[model samples]
Target: MRAFIGMDFDKGLKDELNGIQKVLKINSKKGNWVPSSNFHITLKFLGDISEEQVDAIDRIIKSAVVNTSPLSITLDKLGYFNIRSNQYGVIWIGIKGEMMKLNAIYGIIEKEMKVIGFPKEKRKLTPHITLGRRVILDLPFSQLREQVDHELGKEFLLDNLTLMKSEEIMRKRVYTPIKSYKFNKILEKNHR
Candidate 1:
């Protein structure tokens, strides 16, 4: 199956992201915009794996998240990664807040997955939510960025880590959660 590990956004966060997309749409001439329903923060992208591997992944998630509390993060910056050239690329909203905790959990998952035969990720993780792909702006990026509401500034708890399946249905990308692992509930309650 085509699968990955990710965190689903809460409704409030999704709405905020949607607002950002709307701004981008007004400034950009063309791009494949990500629907708000499809908005998520991908922790790891496991392109394809078998059922047995999925089971191993489950164990990895369970062990990696043990005693882990709900993670808090915020939408802090707007940026893009040049895909083909510097002018056109993937636009994203960068994440910040409680990053040290988030990185620790990500490191555990990366290491454990490698032990199970998955190749280690060479690049350091940059936590961000993709807003669009193959995007070309109508104006200079700095001008377009000024039009976006980049600093969402609201902090939200990431309560669960989900194993997601990706499929193209009716020519649209769809992400379905095969399973979700909730973080430490008692620790979560203590924080609030």
Candidate 2:
């Protein structure tokens, strides 16, 4: 199955993201907007994997999150990766807060996944939640960017990391959780 590891957001965050997407949809000429139910922050994309590989990845997740506390993250800004000479792009929302902890979790998972034969990720992690793909704005990107407010939003905790399976069902992409690994150990108060 096609799979990945990611963090799911609470309903509140999903609602907030939906609101943002609604605004984006109004300003976009055309794009494949991500469904609110599909909103998540991908920690790693594992692509296609067999049942045996899923089992191995389960172990990796268990070890990676050991002694890790819940992560607190907030929305930082709206951003995009230009895909076709700036004519089209993938629109995304930037993330911030508890980034060090987020990176450490990713590092542990990446290192151990490599030991299990997965290739090392070529790009450094830039945490963001994808909002849309093949996106073309109604106005110039520079104008849209300057018009939007960029700042902190409500903070939320990612208490667990989920292993997600992706499938195209009835022409819509759906992500289902295969398993979730909770952060079993909390940091001492002094560590904060």
- lDDT computed for candidate 1: 0.85
Cα lDDT tens digits, model 1, 64-182, are 67778888898888888885654467899988998998898889888888898888788999999999988877888888777775447778888778899999999999999887777
Candidate 2: how many backbone clashes?
0
| lDDT agreement with native, every candidate | 0.85, 0.84
TM-score of model 2 vs. true structure = 0.90
Give the per-residue lDDT digits (tens) of candidate 2, residues 1-192.
999999887688888888888777888888998999999999899999999898889988888877887988888788888769545678888989999999999999899999998898999999999889998788887666655554337677777788999999999999999988677644333234
Off by over 4 Å in 1: 83-87, 186-192
Candidate 2 has which clashing residue pairs, if any?
A: none
TM-score of 1: 0.91
Give all candidate RMSDs, comma-separated. Answer: 2.6, 3.8
Give per-residue lDDT, candidate 1, residue 171.
96
